[model samples]
Target: MPLIKNVIHRFHVKRPLTARERELRLDIRKPAGDAPHYQLSLIRLNSTFVECVDKWYAERGFGAMFGAAAFSAVAFGMWVLVTNIFKHWHPIGLFFLLVFPVLLAVTAYIFLCDAFTYTHYPIRFNRKNRQVYAFRPDGTVLKAPWDRVYWTILGHANPLGWLNVAGHVMDESGKTVLETFALSVNSTSKQGEVKLRNHFEFFRLYMQEGPAVALQRIQPVPLIMLPPIDRQKESWAFGWERITLTLNGSPLLQILAQVFFLPESLFRWIVMRTSKIPQWPQWVEDECRIEPDDPWRREPGYRDEEAIAAMQATAGARRNG
Candidate 1:
């Protein structure tokens, strides 16, 4: 479903990033406003690592299961055609017929895989070690030092590239990309690219500087919606939260949507029953372990401005006491 991540997997950086590539690389040392999409992807935030969702727009569709079924049907058709009708066709036709079943089956498997996998892939920005860990779609993880990874605003398809915040991890000697991951940002213009830049800059600054310094100029962070590990913990298989989130957290709109998207909600309920949850390896988890008195502790973006202010006041008072 996500073209960028798939495109990046096949890519290998042959040379060092040049000046033009660095044009969109805003100074992490400098501050900028944020795109709200960044906050939506946040899963966990702390001094050690800030885990956020990857492929930001991947979760909205309810038709992937259907797509898989469709591809399976096509594969079945090809299988029947090859075995019954086209056994004595031209070499090329026979080749296509023979190859198509496998190709379509592979495509169907891909769809089923995506449908049955985790609700979203997670990317962890390790503030403590200055590393980045991205959960790849193929059940692998992308690891790189935040500094060694070349960060840039990759505008795909001119002004049509909705998501553009991408980071490419390069090998030593500053050549050959090992892996890549896109940050959460949607863009349609130069201004939107700037917004995407700001979203990435927030992470860069947070990693280089601190959350306190990095969050200073950004927008109010959105409440994170993490995938539920236990089915019992989910409300309508997490559809209630998502439906509510559809209209900017409006209660009335959410109610209307529940009524409107009842079928989809039910489908999601069934689909989520089999959804996978990503788990980091022990070594990485060990590295990200928080000390008992880690002074860099910060709260997730789960409140509004006034509520955040009140929370800060309470925290300050507790610290003072």
Candidate 2:
């Protein structure tokens, strides 16, 4: 059976946002003078950390789950190699070959362990304040302030030297870090080595927070998969629906798509047809959903004059407020 597109539930109707609402949305209001209006939907909020984690993992498709399994398998292989080294299981002259394998195995195990631990912990995104707060699965808040966060930001492939990930931050000196890391932005570009230089330069601009210019862009984090056509029409999984979004600026929305395993309408048919894997009943087929025309992936090419003005006005209001 085919999977489907999810429909988004709108949090607020079409209306001018009040000052307080604008603060909460972290979006600027529409400027005057014939500017078009761009609508942004507030997807999910007010959920506990555990709830967010459950939702994130439960909706990922079979491929991601398989990927994790593959990692575990690699870890097991490493364990076997380590055991072989200690037990002298390899041929007497092959000990040197065993050295590399042993190290590789240890590395794989450590990586897999970290992945599991990261997933088990709950990560929460604050839509209003634009901050991510991660908690242990047991609900203990991790100890760290924004300025002192010692987390690693993953790097991505880049071409033409443009940074792929983007966001804004204010440093301790009150200077805003506008553009940081260009390698991520140029990830999809074909410029190759030259683009990496661009990325580094962009990073320099934001690293010092000299004068803020929104540079860190949020890229699509999914392992890329297309949904089956028929499922696109289903309603139960409204999270997959197509919606218009503004892309040109920084701090791209952290979109969480709930790819469907099967539309209820088709699941029955699947169950009746086959059972190849003995434990397949408990399995669901879905992927980490990516929003179409995601700002980080590509430009929307939207040059709406009205919407731009509105956005600028909103930005001005935010700065003044």
Candidate 3:
């Protein structure tokens, strides 16, 4: 049983990063210089392709467990209703009975689908060159002009205010060239909010005021609030085809697709485990690299002395007035 558990653990869990990998890995907190170029630290184990594969498998297993638990809970509840109240079926119970299955099935299908489809390509921003590059897992690269990129924040206002910073590059006709998943930030506390605002301000300044203007320490513009209508439109624009087909199409077909795709996803997972990930090109390495020590790097809510003084003065004035 110990041996079996060890094997299962190896298959399902990612190994921790080596000392050398940790030393060399980019830290997103310390953006290189005060310039408009920055790269978000890779999610999970990104040092090697093998580690990434392990992380993927682990994620899939956890996802499956969660989905199963949800489905089973719903199913059991419905079963109890059917057995106990067969003659006096309540409308709410009947509604749940009908809706829960579809919801669970759809949820399961999405959960499984993500296990295969989710890809985390490294993204870099270069305000100087007016370019954005995404290094794909397959050794290919996607590049887009800065002007063509559109960015928005997807966040909820709560005690632990979490934000997802997402963007996409589009052509003149508004066709998407490349899109990035949210680089999540926790903004629940005052410090977290400052960090989130700083990062957002960096991008906003570069885009609106240009690199030269951004170089100067100007006050940050308030983060824009995306309306529900706009958020819905963005969602539709991002993955409308897949979403529409999955929701509107035959349930039978959905189940069949899930069944068939399982093997393929498993095969890919196996391949990723066995094969080595290619090393990034020298150009990409240089472009995306983060420096260890940058003057601009600071703890959340702690600005440089000059900025701190200015902020304090402003707050004092507001209180006095």
Candidate 4:
């Protein structure tokens, strides 16, 4: 029982996100007009770590269960057909019957292991320097130039497309520098496509033609506000409140609520297993230690108009000089 307890503790214990982390995860907005640095929004499938793991397990379990049911139905039909035709047992029929249980068990075990073992890391994009910062839970920080990184939207056709943006980084010689697990944005609605496209274009333009050109290009698009789709709560009452507020009057949620009724404890357990806490890289730490100017620090409430005006004035001054 102690061994089982240990396993449960490792896989089922939940870690709650601090307010700051919660804010960071949910705040999906474009860079402020005046801020010198812009932080790319962190995308995730679920709000809490445990919830992500739970969803992972739930999805795999559902797939496995469906596959087993389909297989069993086909096998049963074949058995009936063979018995009616031959009036005796056949080797093929027996084989199908024997394999069904084994297949179900194997699929269940595989999905269970997957649910408990997978971990996700946070990837941050800095628009100012065109840099990507990947934080490992083990306190290691990996950095690369934006040009070295590549990204793809996995489910572009899906209405909730922001959940599909995935990326990885490579070295100058075309060697893989770091392999990132698929990360998803919080928005699961069709509107996410616009947000995803805007963000991608924002960075790409800035990197390709500097900030001035990028700003001009992005100016026409209205500001995007991507609020949290999944809310993490400490209790069932809180969860209910969140559901009512966030998912109120949605027919999809009504259907989902009926199909997958997740209790609070199970949701927490899954999040605890899958979520990874990000740590600051050693270089960032060292730089802050040596100087007061921390490059990674975000300027709160920075405005884009101010930045654009400043850039234009600098250009005009240079031309006159």
Q: Pick by lDDT: which candidate is best?
A: 1
lDDT of 1 by residue, 13-131 (tens): 55566565577665545554444235455666667877776654334335544555578687777767768755565666666776787777666554554455555567889987888
Deviation (Å) of 283 in candidate 3: 14
Pairs of residues clashing in candidate 1: 13-177, 162-187
Better of 3 and 4 by TM-score: 4
Each candidate's TM vs. the true structure?
A: 0.66, 0.26, 0.37, 0.42
Better of 1 and 3 by TM-score: 1
Worst 10 residues of 2 by lDDT: 1-10
After superposition on all C-alphas, the RMSD of every candidate to the true structure, in Å, is 7.8, 18.5, 18.5, 14.7
Number of clashes in model 1? 2
lDDT of 2 by residue, 175-229 (tens): 3332121112223343432333333332222222211221222111111111221
Candidate 3 contains a number of clashing pairs equal to 0
Predicted structure 2, TM vs. truth: 0.26
Residue 65, candidate 2: Cα error in Å is 7.7
Best candidate according to TM-score:
1
Q: Model 2 shows how many backbone clashes?
A: 39
Could you give candidate 4's per-residue lDDT for residues 1-321 as a string of tens digits? 223112211211123322422232211234412322112232221111101111122122233234444556656665665566456656776776666566655544433432333233345445545565655334355566655554544333455432433444444454342443233333466565455445455545455555455545654332221122123212334333333333445867755764443442244344434433334556753432322454322232224465567677887999999
Candidate 4 accuracy as lDDT: 0.40
Model 2: residues >4 Å from true position, as ranges? 1-43, 46-92, 110-115, 118-171, 174-321
